[model samples]
Target: MIRWDWIGRNLPEIRELLGDHIVMALLPILLGLLIALPLGLASVRWRRLYQPTVGIMNVVYSLPSLAVFIVLIPITGLAEQATVIVPLTFYALAVLIPSVVDGIASVPTHVRQSAVAMGFGPMRRLLQVDLPIAVPVVLAGVRVATVSSISLVSVGALVGRGGLGYLFIDGWQRQFPTPIVVGIVLILLLALAADGLLVVAQRLLTPWARARSSA
Candidate 1:
């Protein structure tokens, strides 16, 4: 039950929506990673910060996405991409903070000692030793966050900012399945493509980890 005529006519609109969807999805991921790195580092450095930080993030994560949009509208305004981006950033953080903490934690004690013995200072050790070892775990969390962000960007349609989600609303209003089906298919493909890219990145970035895991 697809309309080739409609699809052909609306190709430009569809491309615009897809571009918006990609931006809405990827921006939060980039922002979340930037924010999560510092926070994650702080949490790992100060042992007591880990639990409360994660607890707070979990609470934020549990908030309904719709509710967040409503709450944010006063500040970010209705139908603004910022409203959508802000909440998705928090959701990404929820998955990523734990991943960051656990990834760094997974670095062996002996490795840290080795770095210290080699005269690698705190920053050097973090850059050269800890983070490199943590890449696989962090990338795993990133994959989850990326997929989640892509899916959640659609919810923004309720606020008039949903990327491809607009198609769903349009289809529903007109009682047509074409736009709805197209939205779903595109979202699925986007998520898969994004996740696949992350998998490739992980392999390239952490070849040693792959060899170790296989062994």
Candidate 2:
């Protein structure tokens, strides 16, 4: 209601900022998925490292996002501050790693034994047998991480990284309603859109599970 012209007219800028924030949020989550999947598979293999590694990621994930941004500045510096992507990546481990482990572990022992009996090697068993079965659950974790990162990355703008948070800061200092409203709305929409996409992806990834779930 407060002179809506700024936001109404400047939608393109809002869209760009939202897009960049979403992309930045996603990069870390994707990287986390890459790093987490191997370690999770390894956890099921080595057994000894599972507790320690998962615990560490859990701790990292628990830390405040603001704290992470501040902590990163000392090492990475402001010019390249957007690199808070690393902690965001690390923050995903608690949910993703555990989900990957649980998903693999959930597969009934008989299926694995049957695969091995049919001459599949350990690697093949994982890829063709275990992982396929695990996909449905691992994906759930990825979805959670993806959504959380989307919301959290707005804080990245605090470090001059240029996210929707920039709008938030500008809105506050200038006492303008447009930047604040647009930033909040954009971030919310981005989170919802990402969550919806992950759900669609999960359906695509596990047709059999969907069928079974429906039945």
Candidate 3:
């Protein structure tokens, strides 16, 4: 039994929590992209680095998120968003790096030969040819990472940085269900909205991939 009046009274606080949640969730994805691009490119370019790079990221990903938050609290403090953002960024890297390596690998060999024959330099070829071709695969990874990040941000509530996650804690402590239900609903909506936007982005960015698949 939800209390509608309670919800109405708490709208402002909920909005603030949602805003914080969006910031906490999104900043990691953006940061992970910036870091993963170079690491992924290096892994692909060097070949030998891919196994080890991914191995370390996998280990990092496997560590419990709650434990990581506790470990960081001493350094970043209990209330700092960095305690949450730093670990989540690493998690995003774990997923994105593989996607990037695989995406670049999916590029056909003849395409590389064609780029070389056209006298395109390494940088130009990467920007104009390789990355464009890899967008579909990379975006697929982004979609997964984005959803995972949104879901994981709730864990930060345990440390005081979780956005709507605070609602879960509040609801539990007070023996009330409304805040918990509201939190779940809002998180679900955010995840769906984010995923939908990424799908639209994939279509706009890689129209040819859709055409090829349909054919």
Candidate 4:
């Protein structure tokens, strides 16, 4: 049987660090979602914002991870920048931006027509009709972003950050396998747990949409 002592001993420390990592990872994604969602909405709504914003996000996403970290270190400090938001936001784009755009765009034209027929105001229509219908698609993006970010959060630990990556790195450097195994296993469990939760969330929120999507 596999020993559980290392995991037991490290639980508090691991939880604390992972908490920080999750916080760091979440802010950028949330901020990016705030920016990317509106712009993505406008992109499909107005067309003018789509090409340029998409292009920019694509470029940012394309940059190599190490290269982005290297460039960011000077401006944000070696310890903080590489450790948290810079890389977190970069990884968020491919999922967040496109998904927001697609989710908004997927709002059928006839639905808009119905909103207009009912004389619903722009914001009213969006909140009551469009967004509700679009939520499943948006949730799909969040699922992707969250899982990817969880793993990347480990990467953040590389340059003196928090999360399980610290365990992996320190374990490697010290020539011990306990922390390494525990860390890797915990991170994997985190990702799996997150994915499972989202699956439940999607089913709960988009029960009707699931049939439509599957059909």
State the TM-score for model 3. 0.97
Worst 10 residues of 4 by lDDT: 78-87
Q: Write the per-residue lDDT of candidate 1 for residues 1-215, one digit (tens) a residue.
A: 99978888999999999999999999999999999999999999998999999999999999999899889999999999999999999999999999999999999999999999999999999999999999989999999999999999999999989999999999999999999999999999999999999999989998896798899
User: Any idea what lDDT model 4 has?
Assistant: 0.77
List candidate 2 stretches off by more than 4 Å. Answer: 79-81, 213-215
Predicted candidate 4 versus true structure: per-residue lDDT over 43-106, tens digit per residue: 8778887788878878877776656666677778766734468677767866788888788778
Candidate-wise lDDT, in order: 0.95, 0.83, 0.96, 0.77
Question: Which ranges in model 1 have alpha carbons more than 4 Å from their true place?
Answer: 211-215
lDDT of 3 by residue, 1-215 (tens): 99999999999999999999999999999999999999999999899999999999999999999999999999999968899999999999999999999999999999998999999999999999999999989999999999999999999999999999999999999999999999999999999999999999999999897899899
TM-score of each: 0.97, 0.92, 0.97, 0.88
Q: Count clashing pairs, candidate 4.
A: 0
Per lDDT, the best of the predicted structures is 3
Q: What is candidate 2's lDDT per residue for 71-102, written digit by digit as tens?
A: 87888886253566877888877778999999
The per-prediction CA RMSD against the true structure, in angstroms, equals 1.2, 1.7, 1.1, 2.6
Which TM-score value belongs to model 4? 0.88
